[model samples]
Target chain A: MSKKSVPVVNIADRLAGFSELWSQKTVAVLNDYEVKLAKLRGEFVWHSHEDTDELFLVLSGRLTIQLRDGDVVLAPGELFVVPRGVEHCPLADEETAILLFEPAGTMNTGDAGGPLTKAAELVS
Target chain B: MSKKSVPVVNIADRLAGFSELWSQKTVAVLNDYEVKLAKLRGEFVWHSHEDTDELFLVLSGRLTIQLRDGDVVLAPGELFVVPRGVEHCPLADEETAILLFEPAGTMNTGDAGGPLTKAAELVS
Candidate 1:
């Protein structure tokens, strides 16, 4: 079915339904890109998507993206785009919900090898 | 500067800062795509982007995307992606703030041209 005919994807309800932390669930697909949601706490490993740009939209709580030079802190309704090839780490003091947008088939941890790296899963 | 080193783009704050209606302002750029914000009301023209998909995430108020077969109603924190080549129109009974994701240089009105057709503006 066409995306326009699909059911509306509710961000909060979906986030609340998921139990895993730092594991991204693909909620929607927009052409070549995918919209994923995740709950985060503590710090994610420093990684970079060499060929893809990643967007982080904070749905709730606060998230800080630490870069080599500086860190960008996003509030509940804020967002930041990590440019392609930029090494950065996402950190949060408390539980934070976020929506991510990036090309389809993008690995969450990029080239960084670690246990936190995961293949994104589609959640209905 | 890399996006990770830049400032956070707050969705609500940027939406409150704008005075125009149905005009989209780019808040962030992610590779070939852009994250945009806009305030919408009334009904928009029926049009379709032949080559690009469009995403609508409602921040506040309500929005209905009228498609060829049916309509998808979106509430706060809800989102829907209009697939490429699908004819659709967005409608809202009250003022609604939204975030749009699409490729750069995408025209607001798509193939069907009229006064509402506009070039997306960059807010920052």
Candidate 2:
């Protein structure tokens, strides 16, 4: 008999390990869970999901998560969670690398109208 | 009735906003949800919880999360999850600032044996 093993993938290795913008690439998945990477810039459309919260972690640059009320700014090494049903938008002043964690079917821009609605799929 | 306002406390402000290490400080609590900060260095003892996974986000310096079989190294801006019932330890090469998210009653060192068992409490 053999034991199943989980591979150790360095996230920095994976992100710096690739070159892509606004496109998320899967790095690891555990028990139906996944870790993904994305490079973003400029501003994202305002939107909100009806069912799940989304987590955003800044890797290299500043990121701002704007809500209907105000905004939360995340410098490098910071994280913010956009709770479900809350309208929000993500903006990056310049090129930035970020990591996102959510359920498999989560959308990039929730319910607000925008041209950047990304259909769910396993990329990378 | 006056609109009940939710205060916005900058986490970095609350953290660098103070100088303390290994002590979790409450930054914001919403819907029974709280965000805390801890400054850790050296190595932490191995431990695990019977329920609930724990999240670690490094703010400065480098951090490593060790498991029974392997380990995950997190550079600044990286994030990792330690699943329930899994034995693990945290190590920092130098003084590191970290943000943690979990339920109200989650412990610092989990169930493993060592000198760093932190009983659940709100410190901030």
Candidate 3:
């Protein structure tokens, strides 16, 4: 492939560009997967992706992935992948910066569509 | 579906278990992709994945990805994705820890497989 300017995405810089809660901004793309940054401070809608697994990595603060069976809490530098078709609700006590990875076109709301459901936008 | 224990991967915890240079340890899996942690101190062979894009996120220290056109430098909290079929080399001045995300079976050496090529093994 012909080369062009290679850009590096700084997580902190991208996080500084947006402050909306639960809004995800795409920072980069890998193959068919999209790398997203989001800030969450409250509980989000319970949802599940039927076609792809979703990866959540906490960049700052703490995040809790609430499942029907139990809750999996993640601290900074921690990550968890919610399996496909599994229901999960993500919440954060304080404003938490997170990195999400899933296939392109994967909706943030998954199967449960509501007001919180918004398409991820490319930040840069 | 019935649920079991949810495992959260701590990047630092997985990184602490391995010290070999260029050896990548799989920390988690998302869909058919693998998240790997690797410790590197020197230059790596120029290689390119013919079938998948590769993401390199710096966790600690500095990493410089040398491409045919230019080099993309990454610091902690920074990431860059080298497009598929682009020949590049990864190097670090000091011991650097990086998180790599790519297809589950993607090799470290890609099309330039040699002694540096090894199967990524799951840890914990």
The candidate that wins on TM-score is 3
lDDT of 1 by residue, B1-124 (tens): 2344475787777887887998999999988899989999999999999998899999899999999888889999899898899999999999999999999999999999899988999888
Kindly report which residue pairs in candidate 3 clash with one another.
Answer: none
Measured against the true structure, the TM-scores of the candidates, in listed sequence, are 0.94, 0.68, 0.96
Error of 3 at B26 (Å): 0.8
Sort all candidates by TM-score, best to worst.
3, 1, 2
Task: Candidate 3: list runs displaced more than 4 Å.
Answer: A1-4, B1-4
* Model 2 CAPRI quality: incorrect
Q: What does the lDDT come to for candidate 1?
A: 0.89
RMSD of each: 2.9, 5.3, 2.7
Q: Give lDDT tens digits, candidate 3, residues B32-103.
A: 999999999999999999998899999999999999887888999999999999999998999999999999
The candidates score, on chain A by TM-score, as follows 0.93, 0.84, 0.95
